[model samples]
Target: MDQTTTARAKGSRKPLWTKDFLITALANLLLFFSFQMLIPTIPIHLSQLGGNNVQVGLVIGIFTISSLLTRPFAGRALDILGRKHVLLVGLTICALTIAGYTYIAAVTLILAARFVHGIGWGLSTTSLGTVIADIIPPERRGEGMGYYGLSNTFAMAIGPLTGLWIMQSYGFSYVLLISTILAILSICSSLFIAYPKPIPPTNRAKSQRFTDRLWERSALLPSSLLLCTAICYGGIVTFITLFGHEAGIPNVGFFFFCNASMVLLVRPITGVLFDRKGPEWVLLPGAAFTITGLLLLSYANSNLSLAIAALCYGVGFGSIQPALQAWTISRAAPDRRGAANGTFFSANDLGIGLGAMVLGAIANWSGSYALMYRFSSTLIIVFLLIYGWSIWSYSLHKKAAH
Candidate 1:
């Protein structure tokens, strides 16, 4: 083949191993590792740093606030910039942010680190999700996403357990350093991935128009019955860590491990279910399991109780997340998949972030973890009632139109 022909041929050839997928997965694994590593330990860490319950909430809450604030801009920037470049920048920022935590002796400095970490997280996660959507075929997107989510599940599963082990033998700074190293390694892995060139805007500023569409969809999400399922699911996942801490639970690691295990186990099964049966059927049971899991958590203070809660939570989270995503995906056309996901996840993120912030603050004000659980349970019920209204309204509208 001539030089141009040979180059084109090589460019068109698929890799034997799909190295891009692996690299992306490693990056995701690293992101979750640092992101989740402190989950079981951070409350204790803040307490050690002389922070009161409110400050404890502040440290955790600041991260979500910063992350949630950055989502729209992050999504837009990913569209404007190259995914690999953004991914690399995010990984480097993550490494520095995690390392910065080791220097924080005061709660304020710790909160600063968390806020910066949130920015890094926002950029990195947005790029990863969009990149996967860019690479995967529409027909198989759900399956591809299902497998991709396993990266987070596995990392979340391992991070807390490994973090605790390191803290037991080494120290907090050392564990922080380990998290930094994982982040840096993610940057290295990202370097191996080949991102396709940015799609030229056929209509200038189409991304902006897409963003506008997203905001409107978001307004509808909260009142949508199916969305209530997502909202309730979000709150529970965000605050469950606090639940473990209050019980003087020695093994927060084990608690999360059970959660991750269920997530790891359930994704494939749910992927097929979404593929065959569609999203609505899977979502209801998913919400049911999530509610059941949280209730079990409310009742259980021991490790065994915690483990059962995790099992219930794991199944609940695994099923609900994919079902919601697939539902959103099915509702949109291929051209707008990124926008659709941007809209869907923004709601999901808002639910979780707000859950952490508002509920964590409430937990602090109430002066008891048990009260927080009770509060969360009540919110879930409220979510269900709202969701039921949306469903009924839709049914009546369809009947009238027919």
Candidate 2:
């Protein structure tokens, strides 16, 4: 009956799941599931088409670059246009492009399809992120985002394994067929969601310079941190299959399975921690786990070692990503959530693009995936320094203000 008890009761009653939220989350799961299916297998398909390591990297890089370019416009549109309109358009593009992959026998054609697919990826994901942010009560944003992220986690768990199995048993074209089907299902599920209405731009927002409208300044810090982590992720997803072959391991898909399992275990707990404490509670430890995971991956030569590495990386990745997203959305103005999500994902695309190119070149030059992984892990050191410096500077500013 007292104020503290009353507040706690009300907080506990805040809804995190609703009909629209569930539908959107299901759509996002299918979208990611379709995409994740291609992440590991695409490189192999490209190689079969006579592409080398650098070319494979280029394909991945180009996809992310295209996605990166599309996101700013998509974000602006999500704010000015309605979420449902942008989402459906994006999903339609994705389904079509994924089907196109079935006919791409040449490496050049695959690259072209990937580029187009990335654009759809940018629009749909940005719209989904913004939609979920809008639907979740701010009081439970961290927890809500965590649950939403599980859709991605679940997709990661099975997508690659299923893709690899299909490619081995049926053919690469079958993978494309199934991925296209999943994407179409995503579109169908997305249609059922009751989307939030667009927020009209403020007078100042309308008057802002063109470049200024593309990014949310409040989201930049977390986005930057995310970019550093994503650089390492880019290398892993793109090359892990090849690396497993090089090491004479029979299956690489188990890495994704174990990784997703750990992610599934840690995400909800980390989300609650992030909500109750702060991002620091999760981020610092997450970075350490990621670093350790990459190092383990660098040395891995067998299934057990790979599984260990995957578990560590998954815990770190699952913890850090949702925390950063929640932090970004919580800081941004409600009207600017679309732009904030755009900026956040743009960083992700940029990092992945850069990582693919740079690490691919490294792998090519060194003739060793292990060496490339070692190099990739160092990027997290940069993440930590930036995060630590920000915290230190904030404390200094707080003291000076006092």
Superposed by TM-score, candidate 1 places the C-alpha of residue 160 at a distance from the truth, in angstroms, of: 1.6
Writing each residue's lDDT as its tens digit, candidate 1 over 1-402 gives 012122233433333226677678778888788777777677678888788988887766687677766666665555556677776777788889888877778888888888898888777886787777666544444556677889888877777778888887888877888888888888887787788876544453464565463432532443243344444555556665566677766665576678888888888787666555555455567667777877787677788988998798788778777655655555544344444555555666677666665666877899866676656666556655765676688789889999
Write down the lDDT of every candidate, Cα atoms only.
0.68, 0.88
User: Considering summed lDDT, which 10 consecutive residues are worst modelled in model 1?
Assistant: 1-10
Score candidate 2 by TM-score against the native: 0.89
Cα-based TM-score, every candidate = 0.78, 0.89
398 Cα displacement, candidate 1 (Å): 8.1
lDDT of 2 by residue, 1-402 (tens): 012222234555467779988999999999999998898789999998899978987777788888999999998888888899999999999999989888768888888888999899999999999999888876667778899999998887888778999999998899999999999999999889888777778887888899889988888999999999988998987789889988887888789889888989898899888777778888999999999999999999999999999999999999999999988888777778889999999999888777777898999999999999999988999999999998898889889999
Deviation in angstroms for 192 in model 1?
2.2
Misplaced by over 4 Å in model 2 are 1-13, 40-57, 102-107, 245-250, 363-368
